[model samples]
Target: MANSLSDRSSGGHQAPKNKKYQMKREALEQVIDKHISNIEKHSKKLPGTFDKEDIHDLRVNYKKVRAFLRLLQLEKDAGDLHISDKLKSLYHHCGTVRDWQLFLEELHDVGIVDQLPDCMHRWHRQVFTYKEQTVHAIETTHFKKLLHGIIKELPRQLQEDTVKQFMHQKIAAIHILLLAAENEKDLHSIRKQIKDIIYCIRIFKSDWGIPFPFRGWKSEKELNEMASSLGDFNDQCLAISLLQPSYICKCDYKEQHILRNLQINWLHQKEARQRQLLYEVQELHVEHAF
Candidate 1:
């Protein structure tokens, strides 16, 4: 995942014949069970505050489940997909907690905790409130039972040929997006696409060392770096957006003075990151074209 295992090539998705390539039903079932266990283990109603890393891992498992399901392209309106509505509900609820926690962490990283004690206190308490909602959401989710129903609907196996074709389509679409990207919002879209690819690739790695089907389609490591950069900017914007109004209603003169001093510096950093992301998006070449 760090670098392309296969040498770069154009216009093909074929894997070597001797390689083990199919996603067998048994393997898929095993992966689902493992992910379900991980979700339960991490979300187990712990007595103290949940560590940020644990929350992150829990959300990742949920993404893995959804990404694999999407890779299969199972349909709902006309076909055989029965992903639970509760699963989506739980994912979103957990996300609410993560957002508040991240905003708090970002503040600490920037040394704002001591400078803005009242603001920090409000956000810290807000994280607990969101976590309470997540706990209730977790209690209501029965992923084990839900996944059992899903496994029953799955096919006997998914061939590598089908998987490669889907990946090719995704790569080609990413190229189009790269060519068309014009702003920070477009870069955000690109980040989502990279994450989807990474999640699907990781699913295979969790079972077998399934070789990624395409070369020059940026390695997982490279995609992660880009995603990380985009995420930092996104988080900064969201934190400031949410915190501004809450602090604005205050009559505290000192808080107002501190924010006024920091606002320009923050805006400049955000703009610089935006431009860098745009350049990364524009760097794709013919080899990256599937």
Candidate 2:
């Protein structure tokens, strides 16, 4: 698998100081610097003959950068460095391609491809066209400019704060949110927050030599398991979302029957996954409370 920016370490060459631990402004700066460089490097490859991994890496890195920005609450700072919307739009473009790829891959993995009705080939072709158009959009000068602008502004937007304090606040906030979640949308939000927190913790550990400060709650491994569960659920949701639109169109009876079965299975899986996620969330809340 091609390594996404998130997969790479933020500190490439810098050595952590042996002095007392502090989450200085420069720690965040180093993260932004590395991410910006990674984004630029990956974006350059986007216009080439890239595969699924390339697009996946590009999108994941972009989200890491955005997550870092949000972590620092810098999105609206002075209104000059607000690039979340641009990054989000670009991220969505990548997601569309990725989701389609995953959808097909899911079918193949489940032995459903061979069983799929012939009319579903039309859906596959439609996904191909969508991927092509999205890739072309990435090649635009405007997209490049937006990426460059983010790279240029992010360094100047970082603020100094104690790493311990930052971690506590962010983690506590996420815990509260997770505890309050009542539905899939809320659970999805918590998953994203957990991911961002884990990313930041890893960066601090690898780049700044700071250890994870939280205790008696969730370990990184546990958090990763939770995220993976949520990810599977989200994938099912995306597959269903993409499949639903084609339902309204006219198709052969056999085709419709297969499609309906696929949709029903996906929906059933999603519901089961939701219940499992909710139970996990409840467990997380209990662990955190003690």
Candidate 3:
């Protein structure tokens, strides 16, 4: 991946002469627009496949497509990124069911289902209801029809000059936000913003073989280490938030107690990973400042 990124970066010098670069950019935008269109047109078919595994796969696809579209919009502004943000919120909410489902599956896999609360078993039964609601919301014809109206107007909005201007504005805004994130709440927000940037880089890296912007901006190994740390912290945070005491209150059996201990261990490991990453991120920023 790094080698390909290097080759592509070098190849761009010769690309100014080729219409292929322009065409590819256009094609990329069109493909993204088409996918958005598909979601808008067929969202009503969403709820039938709301199972845990299926929802997890859908979440992955949604993240990739949403990330790709946002990156493309940064460079091309053909679609409304706010729409993508809304979709991400919905996706995150929908993830609660999948997370719980995984938690239960792992418990069963380890042969500890009997250790959990009777209430947890009951909650697991209703997981499908939450899943179905999320799917239904995403698939609603009304929502898609509203999005279709805005998205279909893309080609005109995505002029190269406009996209360039849009990117400049966005980069500047994110930079300011990064600089202003001082408190824990601010840092939390910055982490989300940076994660989105990383997501975009990963998507572009896979799709176009481009060097990630962060690569040019900092030490590759250090940045990666920090990113890994941030990811661990975020995952822990998500797990903690999703596992309500209501879930735990029901998990009070001795073996069920063991499962809770495992969760605590997981949280500790995640925190340790995050602290290491956070220190590294700060160190790099200080070094860069000089």
Candidate 4:
């Protein structure tokens, strides 16, 4: 991915002649189709698949398409990313499964789930149930219509000049978020903003490759590292909150009681993750728009 990213931004296969920053019409259409297809591919593969990466990839594809729709939506006259209530249900179903996956993975990582076999088993069962639910949503949802709407919205040419200007505005917004961020929500805004940059580039690339942040910007790896840290802290925070007595835990009262007894361990872990994320943010230096 890193090598391909470098190749793309450095005037490789992604951009058209003269290696312009913008994508061509045909390239943009291919990108749109690719993401829609990949979303289906991952959603199908996740039904009985044990690999968590598939779930992550499915969500990534969802975000990529959603980002493109969002861009078009902002233009008002272009198009809107208006998901039907049914489609929104499907989207949330996927999220439900992902949260279960994250909830378990974090517990297992901290050795909490490992100590309680029953809790782990219950969590896995819940994940399987939600996974099947997501599969059902995929099979029944009107995604074909949603995808067709996006295809119909394609413009004659996705000029680089327009995309570059849009990205510059987003980066400028990120700059403001960075200086004003005093809490985790602010950090999340920063992370999502960087991801918007990434999603836009990958949406245009045929290979779904991440593009190098335009000239005079942080490397793709560095940007990912920053996002990773913030994501980790977020997962940790979620895991801790799930342990609270009011949460609708899948574990029984007895098991939930046992889990709550060890809540301090997860709390400590969350604090450690918080510090790591803060350090990452402190060292982060957002260069002005390219």
Candidate 5:
């Protein structure tokens, strides 16, 4: 999968010559340029620094770029311009490291680290090794080429449309999905859909004067807050899963027992949080009458 960003410029692609679509095309190109630059900056530093925040930021930028590409694809037939899978693999490479980092932080916050220092230390070493391998996979010529290609081709793929109408259509689809979502997994998917719509709005709204469609149910702030809550619920689920005996076999019997107990408690907490979040999502959907 592609990892590092290449220095290949967008090949000096100019905005559409047609005056009617000039501003819209420029807005699209600007959004693509900004994200490509950000992704490149962070991806280049990955091999040298291997910082957790860098990994996170790179993934975020990748998502932004992917979301922008998705918008283009939705607007027009962007054949051979879809780079979601390659970017997704790159994101997952860093995601493993991120998940472990978050898991470690959760352990520390819940006092598990202090109680089972030896076990935590051993797990930390394993996580470090995994991160090294992931980084190694990322810092390659193929990865660089992939990043370069996406940035180089994106501007050419964007087509002009009424920004406000497009935004309304996309957000409305996401709202329908949110209204139909019934469980934690569904809620998680809804959060991602909402995130994509937010990215779309952010890019278009940067240079175009388009107002958001939803009134009480959707705003950048509201969507972000909802996604954050869902993120916490997801982290708890992952933490409990990682605490399973099969995964933490290095732990002694006493440590294993402690982990099992912690897992059980977290499971209960996750259930409650999931329930509350689902209710909140339902309420928002109703208020919006999607």
Candidate 6:
């Protein structure tokens, strides 16, 4: 699976503190710092590769650095220094790419290429071309340079308050986004928004504590698992989005029936899980003494 997403911690255990934790944090930060340095060196000679790797590293380290800074802010623990938003946007870029990559992988998996009618096959190919064009646009611009500059300046920007503030803001944004989505009857959109919201929650959990508010919820582990399941459902929705309209049109009655069956099954599962999560999120708000 030639995935660019690399697990910096190979042991698959919670990152421990002490000498071992300190060593890993320092080493990972150095890896990030060196990646920035490499981007600067190659920016003039090469272009896309630096941007690509820089974005990947930024996403990889987002939770790590966020956790490190949160500990420093909330607990007086020692951790790596923070980076700038310009550097942070680099992570955002990789995120956009990753979402699309997931989309493409979905289309491929659902046998989209083979499912389309012969007459519409050419149009389906064009849809793939559209996806590729969006990707290339990001790779060709000064977007990469901007991300690199942020990376270069990151170590100096490490601050406890900054990371904590950002986390709070993200939580607020998720709440607001969900409220807006609840008005629409599109389960697809609701599921997508929930996925993003819960993903933000997971990022916070993986960095800080599972229950997110730390003081709330007995089933932090269960909440995390629910988010993971919802995310899988969102992935399927994204896959559906990527597939060409023509491909869908070409499906015979039986093929369409099968597709609908697959979709309905997923939606049923997604709704059940999301209801449980909704209750949990509300409970957290109450726990915060809201």
Which candidate wins on lDDT? 1
| Candidates ranked by TM-score | 1, 4, 5, 2, 3, 6
Better of 2 and 4 by TM-score: 4
Top candidate when judged by TM-score against the true structure: 1
Error of model 5, residue 287, in angstroms: 9.0
Candidate scoring better on TM-score of 4 and 5: 4
lDDT of 4 by residue, 1-290 (tens): 11232345344344443555433445555666777778777777766673678778877887777777655544424544454566566667887777777787766676656566776776677777877788888888666776787777765444455666667777788778767677767877887887777677665443535343354255666777787778777766666776776653755677777787668777777667666676677676666646
| Tens-place lDDT digits, model 6, residues 166-237 | 445444644565564432233344334334434434443443232232222245465455446545655555
Taking the tens digit of each residue's C-alpha lDDT, what string does model 1 give over 17-50? 5564555567666766778678778888432667
**Which 10 residues in a row give candidate 6 its minimum summed lDDT?**
1-10
Is candidate 2 or 3 superior in TM-score? 2
Residue 144's C-alpha lDDT in candidate 2? 51
Per-candidate clashes, comma-separated: 0, 0, 2, 1, 2, 1
* Higher-TM-score candidate of 1 and 2: 1
Kindly list the per-residue Cα lDDT of model 3 for residues 88-155, writing each as its tens digit.
Answer: 55566567766776666655676756655574567666776776667656754354554554355343
Misplaced by over 4 Å in model 3 are 1-14, 17-29, 37-57, 64-81, 84-90, 105-112, 117-119, 138-147, 153-188, 202-215, 219-228, 250-267, 283-290
The Cα error of candidate 3 at residue 184, in Å, is 7.4
RMSD of 5: 7.0
> How close is every model to the real structure, measured as TM-score?
0.82, 0.76, 0.61, 0.79, 0.78, 0.44
Q: Mind giving the per-residue lDDT tens digits that candidate 5 earns over 1-290?
A: 11111111134233333422323344455566677667667867877567888987888777777777766665443445566455566678778777888888888888768788778878878887877776665554355556556555543433335333445565566667766776777877777766776666565444243333333353457767777787777777777878877776778778888888888888888888888988887655313322
Off by over 4 Å in 6: 1-124, 127-135, 138-144, 151-157, 167-227, 242-247, 250-277, 283-290
Error of 2 at 150 (Å): 3.8
Where is model 5 poorest over a 10-residue stretch in terms of lDDT? 1-10
